[model samples]
Target: MIEQTKCNAILQKEAESFRNTSRRTFIKRLAGGTAVIAAAPYISCGKAGDSFEALKESAGALSTGNIGDEAFWREVKKQFIIDKKLIVMNAANLSPSPVPVMEILFELTRDVDRDASSQNRSKFSTLRQQTREAVAAYIGADPEEVAIVRNTSEGNNMVINGLSLNKGDEVVIWDQNHPTLNVAWDVRAERYGFTVKKVGTPLKPQTAEDLVEPFRDAITNRTKVLAFSDISNITGVRLPENELCAMARDAGIITVIDGAQSIGAMNLNMHDIGCDFYTCSSHKWMMGPREAGILYVKKEHITDLYPSIVGVGWEGAIGSGTARKFETLGQQANERIAAFGKTVEFLDAIGKDRIEARILSIAAALRDGISKRVPGVEFYNPQNREMSGGIVKFASPEIDLSDAGSTLYETYGIVCSVHGGNFPGIRLSTHIYNTMEEIEKATEAAAGLV
Candidate 1:
C-alpha cells in the first residue's frame, strides 16, 4: 500500500508538472529528472527520458501552427520514429509508435527484466488502474467500463464469446467488418446454433442514411446483437455508428463497435454512440504499443457479459460488476499498459479534433490527387468527409492492384496495401505522420502504374 501510494503521488506530481510547465521547459526537466517509473527502485531514467524530450519538443512545435498548415503537421511528424525515406500509409493495419511510447515500453520492459520478483512488480497494479482511467477518460467512458485487453481481436472475441447468445438468437453485422468480427461471429454461431446475418451497404453511399438503413433493415425480431466497424477497413466507409447504435438500443439489441479504424483517427465519445460494448487496437491509429487494446462494457451490461479468459484475477472480477472481469487474462505486458496510458496522454495533449482534421485533410488530398491523375479511377470509399475517415480505397481498371501496391513501395517508397477478395482495391490509410507531398507522390506513383 505504501509503494502504491508513493507511485501515485509521483505520477500525480509528474502530471502536474507536465501541465504547468512550458513544453520546452518540461522537456528539459523530464530529460534531466527521474521519470514516474523511477518510483520503483528497480526502474531508472534512461532512453525513455531522451525519447520523452524529443516527443515534448515535437509536440511543443506542433502547438504553434494552424491545423491545416503542412508546416504544422511536419512538427507532428517529428514525434514519430518512422524512416524519412519511407512513406507509410497503412495506419489501419499497424502504426509505428512515437519515440516516447517506445521509450517507456523499453524502459518498463527492462524494469521487469531486472527484477521479476513480486516485490519489484507489485507497482503494476497501481499503474494498470492509472492506464484504465486514462483510456476511459480519453474515450469518454468510465474507468470501471474499460478493460485494457490485448487488441481489438481479443476484445471482439470477448464480446462474441461472452455474450449470452443462445440458439436461434441472431447477430447482424456489416459485411465490411474485419474478419475477426465477421468470421468469428460465424464460427461461434456455427457451434452455438445462433444466426449470423451480414448487411451490405451501397458501394458508393450517397448519404449517411445510405450507410445506416441497410443495417437498420437487416435487424429483425430475432436479432440480439448488432456488430460493425466504426469505419470499414475494406472500403473505408465510416458507418453512422451513433445512429446504428441508437436504432439497436430502441430495439433492445446489444451494439458492439469494432473501432480499429476510428478510435484514434477521430474524436470519439462512446457515451454519445451508446454502444453496449466497444473495442479498439492501440497499435493502429493510437500508435501506442503493439498487442495493446481497449474493451469498454457499459456499466449496466458488465455482469451480463461473461469474461472470455479466467485467470488469476477471475475470482474478484467475476462479481466486480466492472469491465475488469474481462481483462482477467493472465500475464499481460505490463510495460505496454503503461505506454498505452502515455499514448492517451500524447493524443490528449494534441487535441483529438486537431488530429482528426489533419488525417482527413491528408485523406482528402490523396483522394483528389488520385482522381485527377488517374482517369476513370473508381473509389470504393465514400468521397464525402462525413462518410469516411483516413482510409482511401480506390482501384483503376487499367492497373493491377497487386502490382501497383508493390511498385508503390518498391520504387517510390510509398507503402500501401492491396485487397483482392470481395473489396478488390488499393488502400491508403494516412495519419498525422503523413504529409501532403507524400500523398502527392503516392498519387503520381499509382497513376504511373496505370
Candidate 2:
C-alpha cells in the first residue's frame, strides 16, 4: 500500500489538474484517474472509522493498476459482504450492500432499539438531510430537487397520481417500461379517463435516433406527458434520454424517467438529462438498503405535483419549500435512511466514472464469451456501449431459458435470471464488484447447460 503522506501528495497534484478541467474532460480524467486509490488513503478518517480505513488501505494497494485489472477488482470485491463461492449476476434486481454500509446499518438499528424515545432518534433528521445532499451531488441534482422515498414504484406513482391529467389527456410511453412505470399509467387512466399510448420500440435498434424516433412519431396535440425508462429492464436497450427529453421540452410535454436501471450503472448527470421528474431505487445498482429510494422533481414543477400520501409533519399552507413537500409520508426506517450516506460515500470513493467503466467492461466480456461459446444464442441486448448499460439479455431457441437458468444454478451455483417479456431470455447484470473471471464462469456454465 502507498504511504499515507505520499498518497496525499500525489492526490493534491491530481486535484489541481481536475479543478482546471470541465466535467466532460474530467470524466476522461476520472475514467483514467489513478487518484481513486491515491486519494483512498486520505479517507482513512471516514465516518465508519477503522473498517473503512482498512478498505482504504486495500484500495491504496490497488492504485498502480488500470480500472479493469483483476487485482484491483478483487480488492473491490472484498469490500462487499457476499459468499465468494456463489457467482451472483443479478445486479439489475438486487445487490448486496457494501461492508461499511452494512456495518453502519446494524449499528444504528441497535441504537434505535436501545432507546426508542422521540428525542433519542431525532439526530436522524439531520443525517437524512445529509444523505439527501450526498445523493443529489452524486446524481448532479440540487439538494432541494430531491425527495427521499420508499422505492421507484412510490416515486413513479407519486408522479402518476399527482399530475393533473383530465379526460382525453394522453400519456406516451415505451412498451418495455417496467410494470410500475408502464401499467400504472393505465390504472390512472381508468380512473381519470385519460388515453395511454405505448410506443413500440424496435427490437434491434441500429442507432440512438432509432430509439427516439418512435416516441417522436407517436406524440400528438393531446399528448401531455412523455415518460420512459433511461434503460429498459427487459432487453437492456438504452434510450437517447437527452434527445428525447429535449423533444418533450420543445413540445411543452412533461417528462418523467423511470431510472430504476440506470442509477449506479452509469455516470448519470440528472440535470444534463433535463427531465421534469426521475426516480430510482438504491437496492438495485446503488447497493443501498431496500425500501429506500429517491425522487427528483425539477425546481419549477415542485408545486405542479401533489403529494400522493399525506401523513404527519405535513404543513399545508406553509409548504416544505422544496422536494420535501413530496416526502412528508410519515415515519420511516431511520436506520436504513441514515445508512444511505455510507452507501454514497462508498461509491464516490471508487468514482462513478470508474464504476461505469468497470461494469461496461465486464458486461462486454460476458457478451463476447457467451456469443462465442454458446451455439444458436440470440442476443436481445444492444451490443453498442452507447445504447446499453450493464444488463445483457439473450436466448437460444434450442434451449428453454427457464430450464437452463434453473440447471445452471442447481448444478454450477451460478445465479442469473430467466426473464419473461416480449423477449423471453436470460438477463445478466454485471456490476463493479463482479470480476472478469466470474463473467467467464457464467458464460462457461451456460455453455455447459447447452
Candidate 3:
C-alpha cells in the first residue's frame, strides 16, 4: 500500500497554498534563495501537480561557479568509491553505485534471497511503481507510461518489435549509433524483411538540423520509424532528438530514441522531445544498480506495443496492465532493484538540474583544455557547450599516442577507451566527482603526445 491517504492529504495542502503561486514567481524565489543548492539557477522543487521543468532546471549544474564546489558535490562524491588505480572514463559503458543505492541494494537483495514469494512480492511491485513514477516525473511523463527494462537495447527492442509495421516498412538509423541499438533494429528488419536505411551522421556534426536531415532525406512513403541515438558513444556528439522527432512527426513517422547516454547526462524532456519511445541504461549516468533500465512509451502507443517478454501477468490488458508486459518471467534480483530506488532518491536529493549542469560544465572544460593544450588533439565533440555531452573523444597521429594502455595503466592512471576506431583517440569522461585539478592533469598528460 502507498499510504495514499497521507500522500493525498499532503498534495491537497500543498495545492491549497499554491492557489496563486505562479511558475514565474516560484522560479524567481529559486534564484533568490539563500540555501547553497537552492540558490542555483534551477534547484528548488516548487508547488504540487508537479511537472519536471522545475526539476529539470534543478538538474542543471552551476554555470557561474567553481566546478565541484566541495560543500556542494563532495557529499555527492562521498556516495561512491572510485577504483584507486583507475580513473573511470567509461561512464558511457557503466557507473559505480552510490553508497546509498549500494546499501539499499545489498540489504534488499538479501531479503529477497531469504524469501522470494511472500516478502518481496509487494515490495518488488512497489519498487517498480516508484521507479516508474520517479523516472516518469524526471522526464515529464505519466508514470503509467513507463516500463522498467534491463537496458537501452531491451527498451528499444520493445518499441522496435512492438511497432505495428509489417514487412517493407522503412526505418532510419545513423552510422554513429551504439551497436546495441543498431543490432536490435537490424535483427528486427532481417526477421521481418523491413528496410533498414542507415545514413551518415558525422562526429563533429554541422548542425542539429543538418545532422538530422540525413535521416529525413532517407524517408519515403514506406518510412514508418525514425530511430537514433541521443549521443554517440563513439563520437560523443549530442543529437537534437526533440527537433528531429518533431520533423519525423510531421512526416507521420514514429520516433524511437536510444537514450543510454542522454538520459542521465543531459536534460531529457521526453514530452518536449516528443519521442514515441525512449530507453536508458540506468547503470551509466544514473549510477543505478547494474541491470536496471527504463523505457517510456507514449500512453496511446502502449497497448499497441506487444510485450517483448511474456509472463503470468503480461497478456492481461496491455495499456495500464502492470506495464509489466515488459517484465521477464521468473525471479529477479530484488536487492538490485531496491537499490535502483535509492539511486533515484540520491539524484532527487542532489537535484537533476544541478547534475546536468555540473556534467556539461566539466565536459566543456575538458573539451577546451584538450583543444588548447593538445595540438595533436583532433576535436570531435560539438563546438557549442549546450550540444556538448559528458563524453569527449579526441585522436592524434603525432608522437606515440600508441601507449594508450600503458599511459592509463602506468602514467596518469586514467581508465578510458581508445574510442577505438578510425580516427581513434582518448575518451576522458568527467562526472561530478572529477575535479578541475584532475582534468588539468589528464589534459596535460594527453598533451604529452606533442
Query: What is the number of backbone collisions in each predicted candidate, taken in the order shown?
Result: 0, 0, 11
Give the least accurate 10-residue stretch of model 3, judged by summed lDDT.
42-51
Error of 1 at 243 (Å): 0.6
TM-score-superior candidate, 2 or 3: 2
Candidate 3 local lDDT, 333-371, one digit each (tens): 755665566567667656567678888877888888878
RMSD of 3: 10.7
User: Lowest lDDT 10-mer window, candidate 1?
Assistant: 41-50
Runs with alpha carbons beyond 4 Å of true place in candidate 1:
1-68
Name model 3 segments beyond 4 Å from true. 1-71, 315-319, 399-402
TM-score for each model:
0.88, 0.87, 0.81
> Model 1 reaches what TM-score against the true structure?
0.88
The count of residue-pair clashes in candidate 3 stands at 11
Evaluate all candidate structures by whole-model CA lDDT and list the values in order. 0.82, 0.81, 0.68
For residues 329-425, could you state the per-residue lDDT of candidate 2 as single tens digits?
8778977876777788888777787788889888999999999988898887779999999998988876776687788778877777887757898
* Candidate 2 C-alpha error for residue 402, in Å: 3.3
Residue pairs of candidate 1 with colliding backbone atoms: none
